[model samples]
Target: MADRSLESEQSWKALDGEQMSALLRGSLNDYGAPPAASAEASERFRLQLEQSDQDPMDAFVEAVAGLTDAVERLAEIAAKDPLAAAASIDPSAADYAEIESLPKPIRMTVRTWLGRLLVRSRLYDEALPVIAEVDATESIDPASSLFYRGACYHALLMKQEALTDLRTLLENEDDCPIRFSRLAKLMVADIKPLKEDSLDEISRLMTDVTRRLDLGRSDEKVEGQEQKIIDKLTKLIDKLEEQQQQQQQQQQGGGSSGGDPKNGQESPMQDSQIAGGSGDGNVKKKNLGDDDGWGNLPPAERKEALQKISRDLPTHYRDAIEAYFRKRATDG
Candidate 1:
């Protein structure tokens, strides 16, 4: 009885007569053989052809033939012309579908590539779903995904969601915040009214991240440790991103910028004069501590000055700027 049942199961899974016929037809098409006239002939032909054919693994080899080429080309575009690649919809969308169709380990490579791509294109929404799917199926560096996901949540003003992700990142990512916590702050500000505790937690994380990364420790050990700390800080930011924006808006009337806090609007000359200002007098009076002076400078001059400040400022502060730009570069 057991033997009969096993045979029955085997027959059930064996390709139906039609499926066998199709394989036989395909084999004939490939080998230029005459068509079979009966089901038995077709099945016999298919089995014989399958047994005599080139190694079955050859299909896998052929399937991956273009992989290296595609990867190299995509990497070049991502590195040399990220914006150009990101500007097109095909590369990003097709990449997801392609990865989903691939075998297990192959999909990991695709996921990582898509991760970097999503970041470069600022397609946060598109990236998140793929990340979630990858997480469901495989193990990856949650920190990398966390950074992008937090940024997306913050940008969309989903404070609670951002906070949850950021907090996890903070705990698990080492010193990631030493490079990407500003997004947390932005989201923190938006969520403060709903979860004041999250803001406090983020502030505490930021403070910790700042102190540890202080004084430009470029030694290898310090650098690696700093990274671990920064990762933790990123999680904190994500945790705070979900705080209530509308409530905060009602509570503070949208925050106070010395200029037009409402629109964040500043004239170009105002930007220039601020950047070109002497370290004293009106600039000193207007500057929000030293950061305001350099930070408020015109965008062009601010570039070099920011690099210099990165050396002089607290570790957390420099990381905050880094995170802001990292988020921008990745999310576009």
Candidate 2:
């Protein structure tokens, strides 16, 4: 009997170039040779293939001829106009159905390719469902599936999922392609130290928000992300203000005890009589200052103070803080 272990290993081995070409030719002959049947049409697709250096996966995809020509066009569109490329990814479309009808190996490969294109276009939300259709272990190009899926997960901030896929890809480091290996390492490094709601996380959220805005997506989801960033910044500012207040109080406490003890301290017992107080609950505002009048700072000093407050923040923070205050001002 043949070595069972060797046979099992060969079963999972990726298809070679000749194997892919033979499979494509067999499918073309068996499936009635779609529109790429014409010599001119075939030549057109061939010329398109020549426009790019073919990686192993790309070469396999190119061999599918007419069936995947749409994928080629989609890739081109993604490179030029990502939003248009995003809109074109309808799995229910006839071309996709035609791809689905292909042989299992070809169909899975093509589907994975489509998912990869979606990820490349930064359509992480749409990419997930497409990527889900292929089982990486069963894919002819498992490395590509893992890498692209991990990328989608990374971009979407699905840290655990991204690391899971990336680590699995790295488990076969020697066998994995060097490109995938290097990228996987970088992605792992990025995901490892990420803590939720941190400045780093906030920066990633800002990037995502910017990307959504670039795609002309100012929906409720985008609004929510913007609001989240504002909330985090407000909390940070409040914390800083509280610390400043505590430091000021500490400094004042060191030199002061001149006031009467009874005036400074509150009585534990309540007074028996109730006095007439303002039934209208409005309160007067206090204008606090050093020995000077309130709101009387020179413009240069005020601007310098504001700059000092924000000096430690990221450069883009000035714009974001201004936008936050503008919204608050409008709302108030």
Find the candidate with the highest TM-score and give its number.
2
The local distance difference test score of model 2 is 0.69
TM-score of 2: 0.60
Query: How many angstroms is residue 213 displaced in model 1 relative to the true structure, after the best TM-score fit?
Result: 35
Ten consecutive residues with minimal summed lDDT in candidate 1? Answer: 55-64
Off by over 4 Å in 1: 1-70, 80-97, 103-132, 136-140, 173-177, 180-332
C-alpha RMSD for every candidate: 20.9, 10.5
The per-residue C-alpha lDDT of model 1 at residue 311 equals: 68
Global lDDT of each model?
0.46, 0.69
User: Best candidate per lDDT, number?
Assistant: 2
lDDT of 1 by residue, 1-332 (tens): 33454343221122333453454344333433344333344555445446666322222222232333444444555567654434322445555443344444334434544555665465554555544444411222334456666666654445677776666555532334455555655556555564433333334445434443563334665456446545644554333332333344455643443345457664344444436544455433443464544323355644654575356756756656577568657866
